[model samples]
Target: MMASVYDIWGAGFETTVATLQFAIIYLLNYPEVQRKLHEEMDGVIGREQELTMDDQKRLPYLCATIQEVQRASNVAPINFVRTTTEDIVVAGYLLRKGMNVIPQMPSLHLDDKLFPDPERFDPKRHLDKQGNFVKSDYVMPFSLGKRACMGESLARMELFLFLGTMVQKCEFQSVDKDAPPKIAVTP
Candidate 1:
């Protein structure tokens, strides 16, 4: 019981922190994106209002920015290993039953075909023409399916609340005003 609790706590803490760091880095690198986030948050959430999960649906740009951060950051690049219950063929490769398989999440998240200019941090990719947030199956920062991260819901709520409140309260900028450091996504 203690082990399970520790795993949940540690996993949630580490991944969320890493993602938050990437978000700050991206915001500093893309002032325009940060500006748009601020605009949307101010318009929908307002300065005096406390952010909530319900507010997440109303903040399209903020949602898109968070989605984009998860995609671009590739915080959890590889999913946990799974064993095939039965023989199957994937992409023409035959696999016997009980075979161990791991899903490479970064490939899907950063695929040029799925996300054009994948290297660039653009939240518009997750936005529709009408400016609504569009969720993508390919952006699986917490993995997917039945075996997906157990702490997904908690982590998401934490991220939305934490990030939303932070942006609403603070303005982030690079220390070196003239030149910001280039953004890099490492696996």
Candidate 2:
């Protein structure tokens, strides 16, 4: 009944690394966010104490920034397939029973109504006017509903801890100083 240990770690590690690489690249481009994170770390954990999992909730902006990273990463563009239990009409087309439905996770992200300036990377959008993490109905890196990633909660916790620990301890400078901006290519 259990997935192989290799498969579990493989799925978890590869996606986690890719997400972190994107986060590092974004933080490099936005130094202010990095600076703010550093300040928050210093304020909460102080220069002497090592950060712990307990520190995750105390770091509000850091959490928001991480969520934004997950949001903007767009790693899993297309969602998993599911069969409809009953007939339904969608966009003037009839979907019969047992028909396969694959929602576009990336397309929902690109919707301007949900994410303004869909091209720009902004973490503030994840936070409400009161500077708290406002829940978004969108953001489906692991897809959504019943077929959503089984490791969703574990992934979120690990990401927050990893990012908070790394940024708090060391500095990262991009080696590709003159690399051209990447162009979007849909598959």
Which candidate wins on lDDT?
1
Model 2, position 122, has a per-residue lDDT of 79
Which residue segments of model 1 deviate by more than 4 Å? none
Q: Candidate 2 residues 53-129, lDDT tens each?
A: 68866787888788777777777777779898899998899999999999787787777888998767777888778
- As a whole number from 0 to 100, the lDDT of residue 175 in candidate 1 is 91
In each prediction, how many residue pairs overlap at the backbone (N, C-alpha, C within less than 3 A)?
A: 0, 0
Residue 186, model 1, lDDT: 71
> What TM-score against the true fold does each predicted structure earn?
0.96, 0.86
In candidate 1 the C-alpha lDDT for residue 96 amounts to: 96
In terms of lDDT, the poorest run of 10 residues in model 1 is 178-187
**Model 1 residue 26 distance off true place after TM-score fit, in angstroms:** 0.2
Prediction RMSDs, each to the true structure = 1.1, 2.5
Residue pairs with colliding backbones in model 1 are none
